[model samples]
Target: MLAHHTLTGPEDAPVLVLGNALGTTTDLWSDFSLPFRLLRFDHRGHGLSPAIDGPCTIADLAGDVVELLDHLELRQVYYCGVSLGGMVGMWLAAHTDRISRLALVCTTAWVPDKGRLDERIAQLRSSGMESVADTIMSRWFTPLCPPDAVARFRAELLNVDLPTYLACVEAVREMDLRADLVKIDVPTVVIAAAQDHATPTELVRQTADELPDSELYVVGDAAHLAVVEAPRTISVILDDHFGNDLT
Candidate 1:
């Protein structure tokens, strides 16, 4: 099924597809203003998208993007993703030729702690999102993050569809993209947050190192959701990485 999406920016420019992190919608990339034609969408079970009955895998998530691209008649696009979105990006880049350049932000090749994820899932199933909201919020942004920004993301987290969120979490729990790293041959940039406890800087670095051709850039004073906590810094980093030449 095609995920709900919106396309904006100049009609004749290169296309850039923006993927959202877990628990976020297309609105996650609302802060970005770049030269390319931008496409942003909600993942399965995310904002404005339909929920699935059971668990989904990374390939299943990536398949949604493929369906969306095909529906839009887009042959190729620059892909950028965060966290869960980044995991989907890796699969798309490795399994399909639709992606030209790739940017992975605040993501990992695999879920490093499946046991912890299992515990999180169990907690969510029992007490609801409120049970894990505070913990997720802590990893999302640092104490120095703007209060309003933190509040906004926390609300977004609370608003997520529970069943869908749990299914996606299961996908992450079962994910292992380490072997897919070498297959991503396109120009790639891996962005990390210095204070991200979710996917730490070192883990992000390992992802970059494994990619055949990639560069790593770490943003300071931010956590997992750096794009929201440090919007200006992330915007600049993205523009520098994906802007300029598309030939």
Candidate 2:
């Protein structure tokens, strides 16, 4: 089962499942302070989750999420994911009826540059995560982000297992969900970071347009991890997406 943390809310409150980005732990969701029964977990091979054999696909990750919910005896949930996590959410929402609502943050439906991912994997193999932490950090957040938080992220990056990290990287590199986006029927909200170099606003907009029922919101003054950079704004948008009961 996936390693997960759950925060209790009202007894009858709906569960809100959260997924994190690649190379990061469930701690990525720490900034979010919502009233829903918040559930956050590390991807396979990241954080407290056990590592599996390498080269798992995005669908594999999505399946793991489904298993986690099943293990907890939950059949339906409001879901939110960022970056790599967002890709998994797209897969789940398109292929399953478990997700009642979805929020995709700083994510893309298709990988824009496969070459970049190849280079990243090569670097990781040759020099490890420490070699490119700074470069990744630059795109992960804006200059205004607090140094302490950035430091914590760097620590998490370095701590990730090489095989697991590589497997996740490969999954993202090979991920192409453009065609699947049209199949998603659940209500979805796509939140894009205005200055994000990773996914970019246009990619997120394209994802929103492809989905049968979706809305796009571009948040300025933030980069890839808009949830941490603009927690209050994101929380507001999430509350709206999940409805007034979440407030």
Candidate 3:
């Protein structure tokens, strides 16, 4: 069974499955503060989930998500995925009938070619996460964000396991859901940090274009971690996407 963390809003509210980016935990979504039944799980090696030998593939990540859904006995869910989570969300919408709404944040439909992921994992494995975490937070932070935001991200990332960190990086390297984009048949929203160096705005726009029913929103005041740089903007985006509809 996938060891997971869950947050409650109302028992009757719609279930929202929240997944974080690589090398992070459910705490990344803690600021979301939505009024739905929020479910979060660490990838097999990242959080409370056991670090088992598994190839980091898109299918593998998607399978983990399915396993979580089955474990929770959730019939259908609204998905909120960032980076790795977004890749999994793409797969879920394409292959699963149970996803009612989909939201992709700071992610592209294709894998990142620069191998920044491999480098990141190697850094975590050898020198420890604190050093890499600093660099990552710098990349994720906007020019206007306070310096302390980076410190907070660094502190939280110190708890991640190195092997689990590598596993997720491999997953990110292998992901490419562009061909499967049009298979999505549900309401969808694509959000990008306009200043996102990790996932350029053009890539987000291209990814959004493939969806038959999707809207794109670019939050200009943020970098890769929009939830941190501008929480209220992210909140507004979610509010616009998911209003009074538990149906």
Candidate 4:
């Protein structure tokens, strides 16, 4: 349980925890270059972290973060998460005071299509990750995305631990954070991909609308993995949101 993490940037800088999406490890944030201390980690069983045998909730995943912060002696930090990672960010901001600022990228407060998600989970369980890897990769990026980037992400998806991925998928399937948005009092930014079919722009908008204090930003020509497809745009948005208060 500590969740394998790499903390970089200035030692004395404000801590900014980066959460990874489902099927992704800390490498998902490899492109980021910001001022604050960046803490990136792999979810349980995803990378070097140990996986649990049974199912878990988003709060359970978020608790891993709390435990990681405690181990590092970090009291409060800016948090940014993509997809499943964003789900964790929402939970942390709503339930704990550890998060000072929040950025949710290409994520929703709840799964809008439970039937579809259930079907996907069933497919993965019955057929394996290979059977659904192409479909998942297709949704991660638009056709305009570079082939190299697509290949890289596809490989990352393939390398994920099947059991843990399913566990996280179950977490998403059972998750319902619509009511908790109001409790997240920190300055929050909800980033969406205009062409993202996984977590559409409207859903992201709804999440921002529910949050008591939040703003919405949509990145064009990108799909679910907008952070990878448009690293510069994502960087600028994050820097503007988190860099303003370095004190």
Candidate 3 overall lDDT versus native: 0.80
Give lDDT per model, in order: 0.90, 0.88, 0.80, 0.92
Backbone clashes (count) for model 3: 0
lDDT of 1 by residue, 73-171 (tens): 999999999999999999999999999899999999987778889999999999999899989988988998778877888888888889999999999
In model 2, pairs of residues that clash are none
Q: Superposing all C-alpha atoms, what RMSD in Å does each candidate have to the true structure?
A: 1.1, 1.5, 2.0, 0.9
Say which prediction, candidate 1 or candidate 3, comes out ahead on TM-score.
Answer: 1
All candidates: TM-score: 0.97, 0.96, 0.91, 0.98
* Top lDDT model: 4
Candidates by lDDT, descending order: 4, 1, 2, 3
Best by TM-score: 4
Cα error, residue 72 of model 2, in Å, equals 0.5
Candidate 2 Cα deviation (angstroms), residue 7: 4.4
lDDT of 2 at 8: 58
lDDT of 2 by residue, 143-233 (tens): 9999999999999988888898899999998899999988888889999999899888998898898999888999998999888899999
- Name the better of 1 and 4 by TM-score: 4
Residue 75 miss distance in model 1 (angstroms): 0.6
